[model samples]
Target: MEAPQQTEKKRIKVGIPRALHFYRYFPFWKKLLEELDAEIVISPLTNKKIVEVGVTHGFGELCIPVKIYYGQLLRLVKDHPDLDFIFVPRYVSEVKDSYFCPKFLSLPDVIKILPGIPKILNFEVNVKEFPISTAAVELGKQLGKGQNKALNAYKEAQKYFDEYHAFLREGASVNQALRLVQIIRPFTLPKKKSEGDIRFLLLGHGYNIFDTFINLDFQKKLKDQGVNHITIENLPESIFKTPVIVNPRGAKLQNYWRHEEEIMQAIRYFLTKGRDEIDGVIFLISFACGPDSLIAELIMRDMKVVGLPFLEIIMDEHSGEAGLLTRVESFVEMIRRKKKGLTVGRRNKLTIKSA
Candidate 1:
């Protein structure tokens, strides 16, 4: 008698929200899940409707990014009904003396409690507590995978993640690296600078800086004005991962806030090494950010002492592009005049824009 042949199980489908940490580690997460033989569905880009839904349903005085995150999760439920699980990692600590925001640590718990959502697949990403390799193994096991398969998948995912970082080091933006891998387009750096061109440092969280809707396509506006910019993410990861150093005066201190550490280091690096190349610093901070409120004060003080020009732009859901554009124009004009050694008065004031 011939034995009946077994049918292969269907590939599990998983949803990944395209907000928050997605800006920083989308390649890693996407590759890891694909290696695990799961199909991936990313939430749509942020839009006005998404913002309305999030603002209405979200609880408390959540930050704008958190509201957007909730909107993305709600999108997964409405758009991907067949999804078996959604990956909402709990990012506790990535390095010593630095921790993720409380909103990040509690993200998975918040999503799990949301109605009409599928099961969430999350693992604690605390490097001190467990090896990252364990994340792959445990997640695979939950999805009916063998130990060997899980480990192999993770290894492949890590390879892709490393490659992504390499691209960033070579001057590609996060979006470019992500698209290049999927054959959307060839990798290319920004256009070469011409004589009298302006260069500046852009510092902020990935979610706020990269989201076009939230930021009002500020990057594009800068590029349109022939401004070339570099961000904290573009720097080598080693710079931020190093031990915190306090200056001799004790007034200049390293921030313990995880992401803030990177921002501070990037600022210090350019101010010390790339000062000749950069004309100013543009800080894009979200409203209601506790860490940023303190960090902003430190940054403003440091830049003042160094006599470098800086523009601080605060954004929220009620922000308008028209007024923000006016301030940006004024800042750029100031930078150009400064580069030419023109006597520009100290316009060193934080511009707050609210609808």
Candidate 2:
């Protein structure tokens, strides 16, 4: 009689929603899932149908990014019906006194109860409170994986994440880091500048500014107008930790949201230390963001005092591409005129105060 043959281990299909944190932390998650020998299925990019499904399923008052997230989740379920788990990291506090948005903290809970959704494998990302390997260990246990194997996977994931950010700090856009690596060569700080080229600092969350469909190809629009831009992600981590951008009253503006703090700090830097380098600033904010509402107000006030040419584009499900293109064209023209010492009357001005 022949000896019994051993059964092959089945690969678990892990679905990752391609919105929100996906844009911020895709490399980390992708590496981790790959290390676990799981088949990863990332949700498709944001599109019209996905936005409609998200708007229909999500609450009307929720922020646009959260609504888009819901749509991505729905799409993941529909596209990968056989996925064994959906990875949703429960982001709490990454730094002292700073918190993730309340919606992000509650996302997994909301999706868990939704009908037809796959099993949610969530782990706490509050680095101050838990070990970084906590998520890997817990998820490994659920998958019947050994703790040592999970810990090793976490280490490798972290290594890749650090390298990814290093590329970003070296002046590569998120899209470049994600898609183009053959020509990528990391070098020392102070990446070469584009002398005499029009530059502007585009400020917003990754999901808002980088999502092509949601932001309506914002980067391309700027590039088409003979402009170059940098975002919060392009700057070094040390910039955010600086003690500048202080409130007028000598009290720090206590922004507890991590992303919000970075945005505000970047604004403060550009307004003070970086004022001469960039032509102007464009702020893209999503509607119904509690944190952004307060931060934008503060930024707008400061920008006016310095008389920086500022434009805040408020985006939502109802945002129109034609209108956005027109606004951008006008703003770029104003900056060009200002650069060329040509007068731009107040009538053609783009003001964040009224936005």
The top-ranked prediction according to TM-score is 1
In candidate 1, which residue ranges exceed 4 Å CA deviation?
A: 1-6, 181-196, 246-254, 342-355
Error of 2 at 308 (Å): 2.2
Q: 53-113 in candidate 2: lDDT tens per residue?
A: 8888888778888888889998999988999998888888877777889899999898765
TM-score for all models, in order of appearance: 0.89, 0.88
Which candidate comes out best when scored by lDDT? 2
The TM-score measured for candidate 2 stands at 0.88
Task: Tell me each candidate's RMSD, in Å, in order.
Answer: 6.0, 5.9
Clashing pairs in 2: none
Return the lDDT, model 2, position 258.
Answer: 87
